[model samples]
Target: MQAVYSLPTDVSLASHGLGGFDELPSVDVIVPSFNEDPRTLSECLASIAGQEYGGRLQVYLVDDGSENREALRLVHEAFARDPRFNILLLPQNVGKRKAQIAAIRRSAGDMVLNVDSDTILASDVIRKLVPKMQDAAVGAAMGQLTARNRNDSWLTRLIDMEYWLACNEERAAQARFGAVMCCCGPCVMYRR
Candidate 1:
């Protein structure tokens, strides 16, 4: 495979013997799963696969020794149809942080976006986040992460409200001062 080089900003593509980037950015998303809910996992992958960014994007499903081997197989088979989807299965169950580090280590893009198996993303999520990486001091960029629980159960509703508030208010405020402490694994895009 040929090495992919970053486009030079000073020179236009026509003058550099190239055409255009076609909206594609060099970004990679890593999702770590441990006995993840198949329905939710599928939704997460679907959202990623539906990304509108023309840049090369890949979703890495890091399976941390899921006990349900059959479900794992099914998920692997589902994503195997596309070149952009990849599965990295570990022999034993590892904690989320370890799995996250492993995913980061295996990633090959200029930036790495870490997300959970249950989270879904908008098509333009990466497009908006990737641009933030241009700043050297900005180690990471995170966005609103509202939960999509349709259930009317009290606990579920309460959790949704808390999550919504965190994403909308707290996170938004932290973003302004660049004091965002937590990475919020759901929709965080990080510079590699």
Candidate 2:
């Protein structure tokens, strides 16, 4: 069987410089959605817009044949004016992979960030992630998840623990050698 390779990008004790990279690569963020909650989607897009990375960042918001296209209008209205955010509306609903492909085929960002519609990122996420991908041998990188409601309930606490183990222990160990077991889909980065 094929196992996925995923690990967190180590930004701990990060230096102010670009980790020896001559120039930071441009990044394209592909977000696929199908009738996603407008609130969550808005938050996700807002996070991307708020990235502190100093490179060119383009966001592709793809509507993957949502039964209610209007659900996306709220988000569209929020980000439509931002030149970096492009909305792609598909007439029919394809799977997530296909929706991502639509943007992949057209985007020219040296790095591609495949983020789920509901995922929200920290302001420094892309800034920290880019330096790791600057290494020539590195093909992809995964970011850790932070549960905004980790203390809200037992389930949230359990999930938070799982994320810590999966990202910090398991994935971090494997990532030392450019090997990861499985990347979390919500916020994985790739080199194009």
Candidate 3:
């Protein structure tokens, strides 16, 4: 695979003046949606908007033929309010992978963050994740995922446990040796 960002191995983390790094590269966030709940999508966008990274950031929302007009309206409103937000509306339903690939092809950032429409990010997510990419050999990274509806149902609770074990435990072990096998689609970052 081609490397997405060219990070300097000798770069100092504290030289950027942000108490972390200086001259941080831009990051483009890609979100793919198909008839997603407007409230959820709004929360996702709000979370991204709250990021504290001191660098250029852009958001690309790929609508995969969502039939929900209300959801579309919400998306359009966000695009209008945020100068950094862009939208690509498909005429027909396409798979998530296709939507993401299309958006990634159009992104111009040194790093690309793929987040699901239903996922909410912490305010410091970009700040935390960007540093991981400083390692020249690292190409991709992912954040932990907790169930949003864990208290709503037994199934959700069970899935939450599964996420902890599968993502936190199993993947953490694999990532230690620089050999992370797979990345969860809910929230992941990739170079280029």
Q: Number of the top candidate by lDDT? A: 2
Which stretches in model 1 have alpha-carbon errors above 4 Å? Answer: 1-24, 175-178
lDDT score of model 2? 0.80
TM-score of 2: 0.86
Q: For residues 1-192, could you state the per-residue lDDT of candidate 3 as single tens digits?
A: 000111122223354344234568799999898888777777788888888778899999988999995656866686658988888888888899999998999999988999888888877777767877876788887777777776677887887777777677888898798688987777788987
What are the runs in model 2 whose C-alpha is more than 4 Å off?
A: 1-16, 176-178
Highest-scoring model, TM-score: 2
The TM-scores, one per candidate, come to 0.80, 0.86, 0.86
Error of 2 at 15 (Å): 1.9
lDDT of each: 0.71, 0.80, 0.77
Clashes of 2: 1
Q: Rank the candidates by lDDT, best first.
A: 2, 3, 1
Q: Is 2 or 3 the stronger prediction by TM-score?
A: 2
